[model samples]
Every structure is written in C-alpha cells, then in structure tokens.
Target: MTDKSIYRIVFHNQGNIYELYAREISQSAMYAFVEVSDIIFGERSKVVVDPSDEKLKAEFSGVKRTYVPLHAVVRIDEVEKEGRAKILPGGEQKGNVAAFPMPLKPPID
Candidate 1:
C-alpha cells in the first residue's frame, strides 16, 4: 500500500468466474466491472472489482472481490485508480449479463 502496484485477479462470486487477467496487466491498479449471474438470487448484477484493497472494498461491498494472480487472467487493463468501466462477457445480451470487452485503446493503435 505504499507505492502503487499492479495486481491482476479473477473475481469469484459463488460459482461464476469472470476471467480478468488480460485487463489488469499493465496498470498500477485495475477495476473489473463484470456482470455476474447471481446464483443466490437468480439475478445478474454489475460487480466492480479492483486490485487495491481499499478501492475494492469502497466500490464493492455486497459483491465478493478476491485478488488473483495477473497470470491467471486472459484480458487485462491498465486503468486508473477509479477502475473505470464494466464488462459483461457472457450470457444473453438482452439480460443483465452481456458479452463486452473493456473500453480501452488497443496497444497497436
């Protein structure tokens, strides 16, 4: 918690797992906004997660936020402390869970 560090992890809420390795690679901190199918309630919610303990707890309370190894993630993002944006990578588009990528500039671009 001294200098800003880069951390990547897969957020686990119940059985559903949203892959987030690729999105947290280069950034000092990452925010993963995922649409999870709530097994407990049978509903979907937009869960925002991050690498920092403070930021994660502040933003996500009811939702479970677990830190995961960056190597474990497929998609990563070098985002600010705000952990801006959310992506729902599966489920019906009409439903709360939708397949979407993090809004970031391509490396080649």
Candidate 2:
C-alpha cells in the first residue's frame, strides 16, 4: 500500500454507527479488539461544522490508539481516498439491523 492509503472502519457503538478513517488498522494485543491508529480528519478550515463529526473528534481527541471490539465492527475497507468521518444516529427505522444477541444465563439458586 502507498503512504496515502486510507482505511475506512465502520462499527456499531452504543446504538450509533461510527464511520472513521485511519492510516493504520491491525489486530490488537488485547484479545478481541481491533486497533486503529493515525485517525484522519479533514482540514478544519475546509470542513463544515458537523455535529456528528465534532462529537467524534472530541471523543477521539488525544487518543493515540483505539481498540474496538471485534463484535462491534461492521466493516473495514481500504480505499484509494479518505472521506469525511461521521456518526449516523441509530433511529427507530434501523430496519433489519440487529446486534449480536448474547446468550442468557440460567437463574441462580
């Protein structure tokens, strides 16, 4: 891959869809988590004021590396160019989308 290669990572977080771009993506030492580094953000002057993007920026600010649970990851794609990173609110019309259901436990005596 070239130095300018960008990777788009889409994941589900607390009922929201998070789309982000990074320079590097790799398996993390922490079990079951994917490591994302070198997050890419467009130039502040050229970018519009997007609440979703702003929220994401604040959430990831000062973070050098982030570990996302494998189960939460929706997709990962390597593209020739990077796009604006934003969050999509999970509204009532989520449609056929469903999170991986966790197994229930039996009642303890």
Model 1: which residue pairs collide? 9-68, 21-73, 22-74, 22-75, 22-76, 23-75, 23-76, 23-77, 24-76, 24-77
RMSD of 2: 4.9
RMSD, every candidate, angstroms: 14.4, 4.9
- For candidate 1, the TM-score is 0.24
What does candidate 1's lDDT look like per residue over 10-72, in tens digits? 443222344332222332244543322211111124464334433333445575333443333
Worst 10 residues of 1 by lDDT: 35-44
- Candidate 2, overall lDDT? 0.84
lDDT of each: 0.34, 0.84
